[model samples]
Target: MDIKTASALHRLRLISVPEALSFPALLIFGSVLSRVSDIDFLMMPLGVLHGILFVIYGVMLLDVWVKAKWPFKKVLFFFVLSLIPFGGLYGDKVLKREEADSVVAARAREAAQA
Candidate 1:
């Protein structure tokens, strides 16, 4: 893949690790705090951030799905993985491996052409 494509995918892939983990943690914390006190205020920003990240993730998923032309099963796997805690970390690793392989293949093809 080209640098721009790789970079976009990587950014989304990396960001997902934290965002995925954060949502459940914040929700849990908010839920606990709500029982003790008010949490509507806290949830507002968190909800917005989650919404933005979700859109970014979905877009990146579509972008990479096309760029990589990944099988439907793999694409679905990444999407579902983003929802579970620590799953983003797993997805990042998988995507990184695929990206690396793509880069290597591109380089080899260029070398052959030269």
Candidate 2:
């Protein structure tokens, strides 16, 4: 809802997406095993990176949920969204739209109070 929350979520969303997508691509590459053992071994690293990024994504989602005090359904949707391919990107877009809406509402409230 706040700019800081929006900004942090934006970054987490960006980071997690590429990490998650890389996992399956790397796995596929490993399976292909095109004559290079080292290349095939990269799968382990990819899995590690994806795991870490996924944890970070979860943390970021929780941060946003707490800051925005969003309803349970919205929070659940956000968690579910992160599991799909490029889901983080979609989550980022949704969060940004919500952030913009919050900004507009804030401005309106200020005007009203004045």
Candidate 3:
């Protein structure tokens, strides 16, 4: 991949793990807080933040999917993976492997050209 595409992929990969992890955490915390306290102030901000992150993650997922021209099965797998708690970490691991392989391939190509 070119630098810009690679950068975009990297950025999405970074955000995906944290956002995916955070959303479920906030959901659980908000649910618990709602039961225990009347003040439940944290829910609003956490909800909004999680919602925004969810949207961003979806958009980034689509962007990377198209840019990478991944198979539909792979795309679907990643989409589904985002829904489960801690699944993004697994996704990140897969992406990291792909990134490393791509970099090595790019280097090999460059060396061949030189």
Candidate 4:
């Protein structure tokens, strides 16, 4: 992948954690916390924020899928992970390893060319 696409993937890796957290947080606030306290008002704002984060995640996911030529199954796996609580932690590690592997491959290519 090109530098821009790689950078986008890097950003997505970073966002995965927060996006993952937001889903659970939103659920807790809307379902459990809201009924017990006045913080119910906070649900709307949190939901909106989560929505924005999710959209950003989706956009980056699509961008990486296209640019990185990731397989459909891999793309779907990442998407499903975003839906599960704390799944981003595992995803981040996987993405980190993927990034490291790609970097190593790129360097090997350059060395071969040289």
Q: Which has the greatest lDDT?
A: 4
Candidate 2, which segments miss by more than 4 Å at Cα? 30-38, 106-114
lDDT digits (tens) for residues 34-112 of candidate 2: 4555466666776777778778778877777777777899988877876776666677777677767877766777688
| TM accuracy, model 4 | 0.87
Pairs clashing in candidate 1? none
- Candidate number that wins on lDDT, 2 or 3: 3
Q: What lDDT does each candidate get?
A: 0.76, 0.69, 0.80, 0.83
Runs in model 1 deviating more than 4 A are 1-5
Candidate 3 structure lDDT:
0.80
Is candidate 1 or 3 superior in TM-score?
A: 3
TM-score quality measure for candidate 3? 0.88
Determine the C-alpha RMSD for candidate 3 after optimal superposition of all C-alphas. 1.6
Q: Give candidate 3's error at residue 63 in angstroms.
A: 1.7
lDDT of 1 at 15: 71
Q: Better model by lDDT, 3 or 4?
A: 4
| RMSD per model, one decimal | 2.0, 3.1, 1.6, 1.8
What TM-score would you give candidate 2 relative to the actual structure?
Answer: 0.70
Instruction: Give Cα distance to truth, residue 7, candidate 2, Å.
Output: 3.4
